[model samples]
Structure formats: structure tokens, C-alpha cells
Target: MRFPPPNPLTLGALALSMAFPLHAQSDPSTAATLAPVVVHARGADEAPKDLPYSVDVVDGITLQERRLLNVEQVLRATPGVNVNSSGGANVSTIYIRGVGALYPMSMDDSSVALNVDGSPLSTRQIAIGTLDTDQIEILKGPQGTLFGGMGEAGAINLTTRRPTREWEGYARAEVGQDRQFLTEAAVGGPLTDKLAGRFAIRSAGSDHWIENDRTGGPLSKPRDLAFRGSLLWDLTSRTSALVSAERHRLRHYGEQLVLMPYSKPASVDMDPGLFQDSRKTIERYTLQLDHRFDGSRLTATSAYTDTYNIAPVVYDGKLQSALGRGSREFWNVDEAKERVFTQDLRLSSLPQSDVFWAAGVSYSTSRRSYDTPRNTYGDASAKFRDFDTDRYGVYGEMTYPLTRRLKLTTGLRQSWDRKTYNARYHGGGMVQTDSRKLDDSFTTGRIGLSYALTQQATLYATYARGYNPGGFNDYAAQPDDSKPYKAAKTDSFEVGFKTDSADGQYGLNGAVYLNRVRNNHLLSYDSATYVVSALNADTESRGAELQAVWRPGDGLAFTAGVSFIDAQIKTAVHGIGDGDVQAGNRVPDVSRWNGTLGVTYRKPLPAFLGLSAPVLHARVDYQYVGKRAADPQNHFDLDSYHKLDARLGIANGRAEYYVWGSNLLDEQYDLYGYFAPPSVAYGAPARGRTLGVGVSYTF
Candidate 1:
């Protein structure tokens, strides 16, 4: 299951041999070009290149041809974005503009708003689909005025392919290293007059490939299955409705972080009976309604979702096995359940005049509770917490032309939040029960100005303010120690420019931003008692990003993105600490430098088979992540690493076949590193190289 590491030269040659189409030719008229990207965040279908804001759109063609299946892969090559994970697909959080906490807390509100088809998703939820995707939009800066409470920092919106009046479908299958298998299919068509239906399903899994030295068996077998169905009804020429239902389930050995000085050959020194496994289930249903009038549109969206997850990690295992009776009796466990309901109603004026506006009201309610996370250590060694949040907001935005080439834009949100908490903790011979309530109301907004410099270029500047309400830590057994941490208020200033060639052959987008956060959420590890407490401090982050896409001719496309960021805490915090954090510390998981490069080519192949010449498709992607602080305390640093992914295949309009490789060099890096209960540093290593072959057929 392991491949020997390759040198840089070998890596290059391997990528080129498979990804370079030397004996292929393309019809000059059919070469794909860099077209204007349309995004929906502006309250309407507006081309991002024409707008003043910063939006990165990954289109469906790229997603399909590049073989980017999951959320991580889809965002890996994006500028100014990072997904810090704990080795498990579900155990991760995303950081945008260097403004997200890597640690996972079921009670903490996410800094990034993850939306799928207008439905909000929690931090641990699977926010992307493996099939039937339309596009993904990554919007920078605060989006509170439009995306609601969780949009304090940024937003990621994933839209799924809709039901079509014309019959269409695709089925794909892939087999990969480690005995991995994937198969997905989607079908959409008109079921009846005025009615259309779509259904999609995906099933994927991989055998545990990490050899266990103790037993010579693999460490984890990971897999997942997801299903989605939707119905669209054209009630009238001016009104329509869409209803969708989805369910997903996952299983795997999660968070397999070994001791320091990681070894090679894809092996782990996990002890026998490690009790390492993770499981998750998600069910969601949504309804969307739209009506159009002479000059405006009205829309309504509602969703109900329930998710449950359980994961056991041996981050603190060495201490337990040496002192406790067995390893399974003492590892750390995380189990939680959440249910959410959301509704959004909005009206927007059509782009029929120089003046355009939108107004909307939103309401959402969420309830979450955690089950005792300590394994079978003891009956009384348990922790329990319950959190319920009810939030409502009203927002409005307007854009008007101040001059022939100048425009002004502004928006605001009036928000009210109510949260209730209940907790009970019994561990280390201590027992505590506490209940608290939080009620707050706040206002957030943004204002900006943009001017058209030419027919193909626009310049813009903007300021935005966003906030995250205070929260509590159930593990703080004492009342004062459990006091709510201060709310995180953020102010962001940004300038950006977007331009594309008049011929539509290339485009460039760039932005610079500064973000100041008051009462930034931080964590303090009290090593004296081996406990963690939530605290607050101040932080400042400034960064620049550039993204470019170029298509010269002859079926060649190139994409490159780079970002530089300096995000750190500028001051010391309050409350408990044993060097858990300090002044002038780099924000954990915020890499100082990161970038991605991609190349794709397509051309008609020579007549080899006894059929029409098929098109040869090839793609290569490279990514880099600069070293970063692994934990708040700066306990360790994750070294910089390089990764390469490539795919080569042939397509004959309706069917395709390909071979792909991920991390072809077997590059190794820690996904995350954290301290165990007793101060030992442990890390979860990223997955090793994966090679696979796939096929897809369309009808």
C-alpha cells in the first residue's frame, strides 16, 4: 500500500509523461476559453468579473475534469483559503483570510458560513456533494449583512445541479490504491408536464492502508455513502418551487496521529486494541420557492437538518496505557448531536435600472448536545452539555450609480440572538452542574465604492464589520471559570481589482485586506490540572491574494493563485495559561505563504481505436503550504510541504476513462498537531499517495 518517495526530477517527469499530450491535436474553434464567472452572492446572477468584490468561482467543468471530488480538494487550490483538518474528513474546519479557529468545539459558532443550495451547514457537516455539482463560490471578507450570523469572516456557497427539462444523466466509477472504490450516478429529467425530478447517489470507501506494527493489520478502513433527491415544480410561468432531501453516512478510523518524528512506508505504531474509530450521519430536507413579477423577484428558502457524530481519538493514549488498565478504557472521545431549522425570505429588484436593491428577513434555530467524551474509563468520568440558539435578522442592500462610471454600494443587518446552555461535568473526582443563558442584539453592515476603469476592468474598496457572540466552555467545572468568553467583533478593510482580456482569453483578480478582531477567541491549556479554558484577546491579520487564469490556444488552460498572510495575536490574553498562548504568537493553522498551480490540456487523439478520434484530456495540479504554528501555544510547527496531483484520460463526448494520482511523491506532512492531556505533543499525518483509474459515461 506504500510507494517509495520520488525525487523532484522524477516527480516532474512522472507528471509530464502522463499529463503532456504530445501526439494530439485540437480543432482550433473548440478550445475552451476563460469565460466570465457568474456568482449568485450579489442577490442576482452577476458576473464576478463585472462586480467589485472578491469572489473565486470553481466552475463545473473544472470540477469534473480535474477530478476534485470532496470539499477539501475543491478548495485546496483556491487563493486565500485553507482547510485545517485532524486527518478525518469530518474532523476539520476551514480558514479564510486567516480568520478561523482550527480547534473544533461543538458549541462555538463557525466563523465561515458553509451553505449548500441556500441551506446553512455546521462546521462538522459535509457541505459538498460528490456528484451533481454546479459551482462553488468563495467570497472573501465579512458577509454578515447577507449570509447571517455565522458569516463573520467569509462564506462558501455550493450550488448543486438542478433538475432539467431535457433528459440527462451520468455514472462514474473509480478504483484506487488501498483497495479504494468509488461509484456515483446522477439522473435528471422531466417526469411530467410542469414537473421535473433529479436523483443522485454516491458510495465510496477505502481499505485501511496504514500498516500497524503491533498486529501487522491496517489501522483504519474509511468509507461513506450519500443520497440526494429533488423535485422542481413550475407552478406557473412566473412562480416555481423546489423540494430536496439528502442523507449521508460516514465511517472510518479517525485522527490517527502518531508520535513525533514521523516514519515512512505508510505504517503506524498503534498499540493493539487502540479503540480508534469515527462515525457520522446527516439528514437534511429543504424547500425553495420563487416568484417573479414585472420588475422584481421574491424568494423563500427553508431547511431542516439533523446531524450526529461520534469519534474516539488516542491523542492522550500513552499516558493511559502506562497507568490505566488498558488503552481502550482511556482514549479521548467526542460525541455530539445537532438539529437546525432555518428560513429566509427575500425580495430583490430586477437589474432593470441603474438602481438595484434587495431586502430580506431570516430566522434560524439550532440545538446541540454532547455526550460524555471519555471512554470506558469510569462511570463517573463523564461530561455533558446542551446548547440551544435562536437567531433572527433583517437585512437590506442597495447599489446605485453616482456617476456614469462610479457606483456606491451599502448594506446592513439588524440581528438578535438568544442562547441557552446547560452543563454537567464529573471527572478527576470532581462533579459540577451549571446552567446559563445569553441574550444579545447587535447591528452589522458594510459600505463600499467601485468605479469602472474600462470596459473590462473595475476597481473597488470596502469596509465591513462582523461579530460572533460570546460562548461558554462546559468543562470549566466552576461557575466563574465557566464565564462566557467575550464576543469576537471584526472590522475589515479591503481593496480589490478584477480585469479580463476583451477577447475573453485570460483574467486576473487580486485583493489586499486588513482585519482587526476585538476579543478574539483563544484557548488556554492549564497544564497544572490538565484542563482547557476559553479566553479572549486581540488579533490583527493582513494579507494579499492574486488569482489568474490563462488560455493561450490549442486547448490549453492554466490557473495560478498565490497568497501571503501575516496573522497573529498582538497581545497577551486573560485567564489561565501555562504558555498555552503568548503575545506576538502566530495564529495556529495560519500559514504565512500558500499557493497553487494548475494546467489542463485537451486535444483530439490520433485514430488508434476503430472509432472516431476521442479527445485526450490531461491535468496537473501542484500545491504548497508554508510552515505554520500547530497549536495556540506554538508547541510545534508544521513544516512546509509540496503536493502534486495529476490526471490523464480520453473522452468521446458521452464517455471517458482516466487515471489519476494524489500526492504522487508520497509527500508527508502533519494535518494538525496538539498537546495531549499531560503535555505531550501529538500529530495527525495527512494521507499518503493514492493512485486510481476511473471511468464515466453520460446519456
Candidate 2:
């Protein structure tokens, strides 16, 4: 299907109308007040209104109320963000500001960086399980000076709940359609006068929503379990120590793909040999220490992470017969492991001072290995590869008040990266071996100016530079793939404003940005050899975002967000296989227009059924995602769609019960599309309407 291009004039008008200039508004009615939210995505903690860049924060309470199970769900409601999955629970791609990798192949690294408790996760794997969290912060635009190579596009930071002096705990259970079930619990308290401990656990799973017609069996099912523990100790009057650990296990059964353009919304027809079975395990450990002096503080953090994954399946579908293969089946097995260790140290002046300054140094090393074995009619072949990477960086930032109402900020970082690749192949009674080494060094920087127009309003402008280091391709079957690619870089400029009413009854924030990228890394798949590789191109993106929150009266609140992006390639390139990509094409997986609207009401209810102090809560939310191109050629696509979710409940302070529904309209949409062997195309389908009820208790 084809649609008309979006009109820029109409979009500009809409943005101006929705996000008028910051100005004071008068209202006679008194309303409840809202507190300012603080975020720490930068090196130091500060209120979002004071930052020169766009940032979004979601608290743990909102996550629970929405019953969000993964990071993808959290990002769907955020402005200027998009998520695409390969029809699996453990594989996904996230896009911010039209910058992201689009495929599930293990070789491509994500443009956006994700961190938990200051420890970065490998972008090659799925970032799941959002349990026992304090808050999630999303920083838009480049974070090069503070984060180094990984923050080419942006960054996401997750903070976990810490141990407390007083004992407290909570538990929740829920059951829903498709045999969905979930149970989670958390507890925290003091172990001794100076020692505190916290623990959390979660077990969740769901039956297959898609069924196979060939064998009358389920096409996909997911199960997951996770545990986290932490301990905090006051070493002395001026120093403290903290230790944390986490483990997660996930399993999936059956294939994650469906026959596109032919299969029904929730069904598939495939050969029994194509069934997929996979398992993934991840573990992480971290230790942190902090010392405070009269005017400054010193902090250090050390972290280690390990991940393992395995999958065995038939690569060829029923198309084997159609391609005149004579019932020959292709069996393949994949096993992979990754280990990373990182250390960071920083010193900063107290934020309360008129002049604030912070400096940090970081170092990280990672090792990864993978083995793939294939069996084609008793002809066995295997490929084995290993990768090693080491990175080091030093960064510093300073913010000084030039005047009572104006400030200037500047930061810079220098990074060095080195990578080594070793590969071996054995097949057809022959053996081959290869080795390569590559290294690069680069510098990134940021500059910003902020002005307080009024006591409650701030206006700012910023410029930043970021980059992603080059590396060897995992699937190096050809000479071109063996050579390392050049690093990708971006230059961005932004201007924004934030304002709030004196009574805190209304708030508004918006930004406009322009970004130019050079040597942008992209992933391409070869249908003939089933190999995925990397390529580079040039692109440009410009966009605007607006968000508003209002509390017109007691027990009533409304929130809305809107984004408009125009991203396109500036140069042509030769893709994998025999495909030529032309210039002037929109980047894949980026929507032109996205928005969200939400309403919430809470009120105290009269006592009933011998219950005392009961309160009722109701919420409704709607999201719109515009049509997007699936490939560089703009030949295949995903249509525009909308989703609605609602929740209603009653609760006291310690206990609550609620009923919730998602995709209430039962809309059917495609999450992603890909081309496979035998010239066939397939699409991963999104979920339909789902209804459930849950209960929770606090002690």
C-alpha cells in the first residue's frame, strides 16, 4: 500500500498552535499543586526544567499503574520514539530521533545506549525486565561528553530502589487472557545499625497467542524469571559502600515469524522442522563507593556482566520444496557468550554552590564468542568467531553562573577504542582461519547557554557532537566484510523552553533540533546466504517535540505529547546482495508524526461494604504512530495505527484492586517486516486486545 507524503506547512501550524510561546496565564479557580521532578541523566542531578536538552522521566508508581512489563512498552508512550521487534520476546530494536539499528542480527550495535544503576548493557541483546525500579530517565540528543562512544544517538538510564532504614515490602499478582500470569515481590530493611539490605523477585509468562495450522501447535510462548539483591553499608561518617547483583533467565518455544501477506492476524502455516527453541541468561554485579568532603565528593563504581544464549532450529521453511530442494532440510544451531567489566571514578563539587564542576574517567573491556553449526542433508559445516574490545575515556564538565538569571556550560571528552577479531570455518573437508585488529581515537564536546526569562520559565540552546566506534562484522564471508568500517558521527543543535505556572497547576516543555550524520552505520541481510552485514551512509534529521500537563481541578489531570520528524538519507549506497539504495529516501522505522494523550481521575469514595477510606482511580490513554518505511527502497511499509488502554480501580493506602485492558480496539498492526529466502516476505504481528485483573498489598 502507498500513501501521500506528509505536508510540512500543516505540521508546522499544528506545532505552533499546540506549543505557544511561554507566557503567564491567569486562572481564578484554585487547584492541587504538583511537585517538580528531578533527573540525573547528566553527570549531576538537576531538575528537568533547568536542563538545556529534552529529557523524559517515568516513576515506578506510573509503571505499576500501567502494568508495563518491558522497556518497549514504556518507550511507546514517549514522544519521538519507536520500537520494532523480530516477533520474539528477547529481540527488539529501539529508535530515537530516527537513529537506530533495524535488524535482530547479533552483529549490529544499537545507536542508543542503555544503562542500569550506571552499568551499561551490551546493545546486542534484548533489554527486558523492568522490576523494582525507582525511575527511568531518557535523555534526547547526543551525550558524547559524559558517556563516550555508546551515546551516539542518546541514552536511557535506569535507577533501582535502594535499601531503607525502615522495614517495608510489597507483593502483586495478576491473571489475564492467553493464560497470562505474573507474580512479583520486593522487601527492604536494615540488617544492622549501619547495614541495609533489599531484595526483589519476579516470575512471569504467557501462552502462545499465535497458533500453527500445520501441526495444530502453538507458534510461540515465553517464560521469564528474575532476581535482584543489594546491600548498603556506612563505612564511616564521610564514606559509604554499596553492592548489588542481578540474574535473569528467559525461554521461548516455537518460531517467532509468520507468513506475511497471506497468514491471518494471529496464525501461521509452516513446516514442523522450522520450530524454534531458545534460552538466554544474564547476570550482573556492581560495587560502588562514595566519600563526601566539605565542598566536594568522590565516587567510584565497578561492574561486571555475563550473558549466554543458545538456539537450535531449521532455517529453511516449507519453501524448500517450492525451491525444488526435494524435501532437504537445513538444521542450524547457535551458541553465544559475552563478558564485560567496567570501572568509573569521578569527583564533583556540591550542587548547592554557585559554581558546579565534575570530572570522571572510565575504562571497559569485553570478550564475546559464538559458534554456529549447520547440517544440510548430512553435510556438516560450522563457523566460529571471537571478538575482543577495550575502551578508555576521560571527561569533565563545568557550569558557572554568569549572572543571576543566566548560565554557561561546557564539556569535553577524549576516547580511545581497540578491537580484535578471530574467526575459523570448517566445511566441505576444508579449514580456514582469519584474524584482524583495528583501533581509533576521537574527541567529542558540548556547549550550552541557559537564560531564566522569569522565576518560573527557562529558555536554552545547545550544540553537541557524538560518535560510534568502528568494528569488524561478525558474518565476514566476503573480503568486503573482513575490512573494518569507519566510525559514525553526528553534529546536533537544539533550542528549547520550559515553563510552569506559579501554582504548579500547569506545565509545558518543547524543543526543536537539527542533526547531521556522516557515515551512519546500517544493517543489511543477504537472502541467498542468510548472512547479515553492515554498511555506511549519510543522513540528516530535523524534528520538534511538545509536551504539556494540566491539573485544572482537584482529582482531575490531563497530559499530552506530540512529535514531528523529517529524516532522510543524503547519499546513495550499495546494500547487501544486488540492491542499490537511492538518495532522498526516508530512514527506515522512523515515523513522521507521533503523539499521545492521557487522562486520570482520583477521588475519595464513601465507605461501603464495611470498608473504610476507600479511593477510586480511573485512567485512559491513547497513542498514535504514523506510517513508516521498512526498507531503504521504500517498497515495503507498515501502515499507521492507534492504540487505547484503560484502567479502573479502588484502593486504600495499603491494598488495591484494579481491572485493565490494552489494545481495547482490537487493532491489528505489523511490528516489523523482513525478506527471506525463495523471494518471500514476512511480517511480525503485534498483539490484539487484552484484558486482565490484578491485586496488590503493601506492608
Candidate 3:
């Protein structure tokens, strides 16, 4: 189905900006002619533009222009962002500003907080693995009052397109090198004048790009599918509700690069035909009711999520008999299930000249289970494990105008959490029922002040407290002796300035922040016994970020940003000491310097050129990632690299075609972390240069 052309409201506005005020010079005899320019438009709840904070918004066009498949690739150009991968198509570890989940081995667990469509989605292996999104917003710094719990450092909010009143649909298909083929589509329209709905689906599968020279065979085949739908009902002029649901599944026969940078790295490559098998599925359902009265708003949100993961992990060296006397194949098979339910209610008072406020209450409960059914070749057998956690929180924030130029904002959150863990097995083949419970409550607060220094500039400073709740270990532990972990906390202080000139052609924002973390969590493996576990250690991180955008002329735009980090362990508590990680030691995978630039030009050709000819459009972009460490030991470092990606295409409004290239330089770099027999560095080598073409049509 095709819909009418978009309304001219937005186009007319842009046209006016272009034609009438092309320049500031006219009637050169006495005076200059300058047209009226619109200044910054702040949101109802938006803080002062000059608040001492750094926030980045990546919109829909930018996401598609870059052709990034997932957040992992999209965030590569984001300053202070870091990633660690195990292998191709495997688990990816994410960190922002030197803070992220300790370590994630499977689909049900992750440390970073993920918020989707206004609902909080906890960090999970699968959550980050698959996302067909609309726009991504990354807020840097401590966001304790609003997001709570996992928002220790900040929050990653992903906004998906909602239903529209006009009937519209688009579909795209892509094929490229490495046998990569994918299809994605979305359809939406008004079911009735007062209601609208949308449906979307995406599926993709790819053959392993890397070849196992020893076996002369491909290592894996990757497959994925996702379906989603949402509906909006306008009950009244001031009241409406939305419901959304999504299901995703992934199956693959893949490889894990267990050895890296070894003198004989090739010797560790297992036969390509002997790859591991992994599968995961996730389903999410959410409902929200929003009501507005007298410019004040109320919202209630509820969500349920279920995730299942299974993997038959292969170990080539572990299978090889120490004496070279056996030819048996060995592997570890593991499976886990997780279910989560959450509900929250929020009441926000629109910002007024005198006062603005927001208050909310939230409740969440989760149950997780891990099981290993069997083991082969003298490997330890798996046992059943289960954990349950419940959380309740109440939070409120108030902003008051102390003077015409000065404003103060204060917020507080009180939370309580209870966790129960049941471990069924430990070392020495001993089975024991070990159960433990923990109950703790704490309050977090934030204070911020902003001053409008001038019409185009503002200054702000803030101090906040952030916290992350601790829980029972995910993997092996003797049940009887286990104890619930304590909540980790951090104090953050920051100051900054932001400005947008009257011409509206230039904008600059920058901030500096210092953070001190108490009981920092670290995930590491035991050399003697290969179990990965989380440990609490003391640490601190400080950083600065600066961003500027300049659109000197129509069809010409430029953006540049820089980030510097100085993170370290403040005290020696765990076996790893302060000396082990010295001050000024760059955080792993976090580049001290990151930058990006892009140029785009689009215009219509002369009518003389064929009348049927499509419009000509072109774009080019550049990104740079500086050198950084890859391991906690801070031993080996990943070399800094620069990559260029370019795309040229033509579109008639309804149908479009484009050709693109990624990693144009074919730069080789590590993307993830892993443990090898002799190598401590853990990271997956990224892909080389590849070419592809895409076509899409809207009806």
C-alpha cells in the first residue's frame, strides 16, 4: 500500500530557511539585511543546555547512512566506548567511560543497562547481540535517580519507531561477500482514525568469512530472525496507551578463537568441520499507559521477558590427550533459562517558571537457572543452579528556579533488593544444597546547578551518587559458603559549558567528570581451576569529552569529538593490587582519542540530462580509533587504526539503490576477549574490507 506524500509543514520551514535569508548583506550603501533566526528549543524536562554533562544523540538517517548492523559496530566511532568479543558471531562485551558489565558468557547475563522503547531491558548476552532499532541515545555520567540499579554510569536508551497515521511500508534485501544475505521490512498504518499499528520483521544468515586452512572448510553458519509489532490507542485527547511485543531467535554452528598471538597460533585451529553449536531465543512483551492533565503527565509501564540459551562449546587442546594417546572429541554443553518481570509508575510535572518535578515507583523480579546435563572425556559433570532476585524502588526529583539566571535541581532514590541463590554442586563431585539471601536498602541523591551566562552560552555543575546492586556469582561456587554480594557505589562530580550561536550554524558542548567507585566488580578466570567469577575491587575513573557540530552551509556539515580517560584501582583489596594497575594506565579497549568526519551533498541535476534520470547523491565518512589495551593485565595493546567508508546512491522517494564498502582499509584489529593456553589477550580479530550493494522500496 502507498500513502500520500508527507505533509509540507517541515519542508516549508526548511525552504524558508534556505531562500529568504541566504546571506546577511543587502543594499550595500548603508546597512546589512539580517533575517530572524530561531534559537535553541528546549524540551519540557530538558536541563539547561550548558549543564556539565555530555550526551550524544544518533538519529535514524545517521544510523542508516552508516549501514551498521548492530550497536557494536555503530558505537565504534563513539568516543570512550569499548568492546570485547570472544570470536566471530559470538558474545560481545561493551563498556562506556571505563564502566560496563564485568563479563558475560551467555545470553541471559550482562552488566550494562539497556532501555528499549521507554522500558528498561536489563543487560543480557542476546540483548546486545540482536537489535533492529530506530535511534540510539547514549547519556554519559551517573544517572542514578532516573534509571536506578544498573544505571551506575549512565543509560543506553533505544527508541523504536511507533505507528503513524498514514499507511506506509518499506522493504530491503542485501547480499554481499562472505555469503552474507539479509532481508528486513516494516509496515505500519492507522487501523482507525483513533488508533494506529505497525509490524516489522528481519532475518539474516551468513557463512563464516574465516577459513580453517587445516581442514579446508568453513567454520560456521549463522542464522537469525526477529519479528515485532506495536499498537497505539488514543482513548482521549489527553490520554493514550501503547502495547508492543517482539520475538528473536538465533542458531549457529560457530568457532571460538581460544588462542591468540601465539608463536604457533595456527596449531590451535581445530578442524573447521568440528565447530561448536549454539542457539538462543528471546521474547519480550510490554504495555504502557500514558495520561496527561493540565500539562502534567502520568505513565505506567509493565514488561515481561524470557530468554533461553544453549551452547556446545568445543576445546581443541583440551580434547588432545596430554600423552597424544587418545583420539576422542571433547566439548562442554551448557544451557540456561531466565525470566524477568517489571512494573513501574511515573508522574512528571511539566517544567514551569517556578518549579518542576518527577516522582516514580518501580518493582522488578527475576529468576535464573543454569544446568549442565553431561560431560565427556573425564570432564566434570554439570549441576543444576538457580537464583531469584526482587527489587523495589521509589524516586523523585525537583527542579526550582532560584533566580532568573540560576536554577537548582535535586533528586533522591530509595531502593531495596532481596536475592536468593541455590547452588547444587561444587568441586570434588560433592553435591550440597547451599542457599543464601541478602536484604539491603540505600538512598542515592543528585544536586545540580545551572547558570545562563549569556544568550548563547550557559554554565552548569553537578554532583551525583550512582550505585549497582551486587548478586550471587553466576558460575561455580560452594553453595553452603556463598554470601550475597554488597551493592557497589560511585560518586561523580562534573562541570561544563554549551553554546549555540545566533546564526544557528555552529554548536559546541563539553564536560569534565571525576568518578570514584567503591567495591568495583571484576570478572576473571582462575588459572588453576578455569572458572570465571566476579570479584569486588576498589577503583576510580576520570574523563573529559568535547563535541562540536558545524553546518557552515547547506548540504555541508562536519562534527568532531575527543575523549580522554585516566582510570585506575584506588586501593589494593583483591589479589590484584594498586601497583598491578597504576594511575594513568589507559582503561582496556577505551581509546584516549576518537574522532569522525563526514561530507554529504545532494541536489537535482539539470533537466537537460535525461528527464527520467534519478537524483544524484553522494557521501563519504572517516573514523579514527586510537591505541588502547585489550586485557585487564594491561600487557598487550591493540594498535590504533583509521577506517574510511563511503556510499553513493540515488533514490526517487519510493525506491532506492546504493553501493557501500566497510573497513575500507581492510584494517585488522581485535574486537573481543578470550583465554588461550599461552595468550592472555582476549579479543576477536575484526573483518577485512568488503563490498556490498543494497536495494529498498517503499509502498
Question: For candidate 1, lDDT tens digit of each residue in 1-699?
Answer: 533233243333234333433334334347455545678886677778545568888887778766677767676567677776666545666778888753433345577887888888876663345467889888888898887657778888888889999998877777777777767778999999999999998877776755566677667667778889999999999999999999888877466666555656455555545534577888889999999989899999999999887777553344345333345323557677889999999999875456778899999998888665565465567777888889999999888899988989899999998988888777668878888988888888789998889978889999998887777663454555566766788999999998888887888889999998887776566644557677777778999999998888888988899999999887776465556467888888888899999998888776666435578888999888899888766777888889998999887655667899988878887777766444556566766889987777666
Best by TM-score: 1
**TM-score to native of every candidate shown:** 0.91, 0.91, 0.85
Better of 1 and 3 by TM-score: 1
Give per-candidate clash totals. Answer: 0, 0, 8
List, residue by residue over 509-548, the lDDT tens digit for candidate 2: 9999988889887667665666667788888889999999
* Candidate 2: residue 57 lDDT (0-100): 89
User: Candidate 2 — number of clashing residue pairs?
Assistant: 0
lDDT of 3 by residue, 1-699 (tens): 111132243233223323332222222111111222211111133533633356677765667667766666666767866666655333566666766544443332333556776666655442343234666767676777776766777767677778889998766666666566666777899999899999988776666645454555445667778889999999999889999999877776443554455321223345444444577787889998989878678988899988787766555542343314254445555667889899989888754435777889999998888766555644355667788878899998877778988879788999898877787763476666777777778777689998888878888899988887777766654552245455678888888888877776677888888888787665555543445555555666778888887766644567677787766655433343211444444456666677777776555443232233344556788878877776555656778888888877665444556777777887766565443334333334666676766666655
Scored against the true structure, residue 465 in model 2 reaches a CA lDDT of: 93
Relative to the unseen true structure, what is the C-alpha lDDT of residue 15 in candidate 2, on a scale of 0 to 100? 41
The lDDT per prediction is: 0.76, 0.75, 0.64
Q: Is candidate 2 or candidate 3 better by TM-score?
A: 2
On the 0 to 100 scale, the lDDT of residue 64 in model 2 is: 83
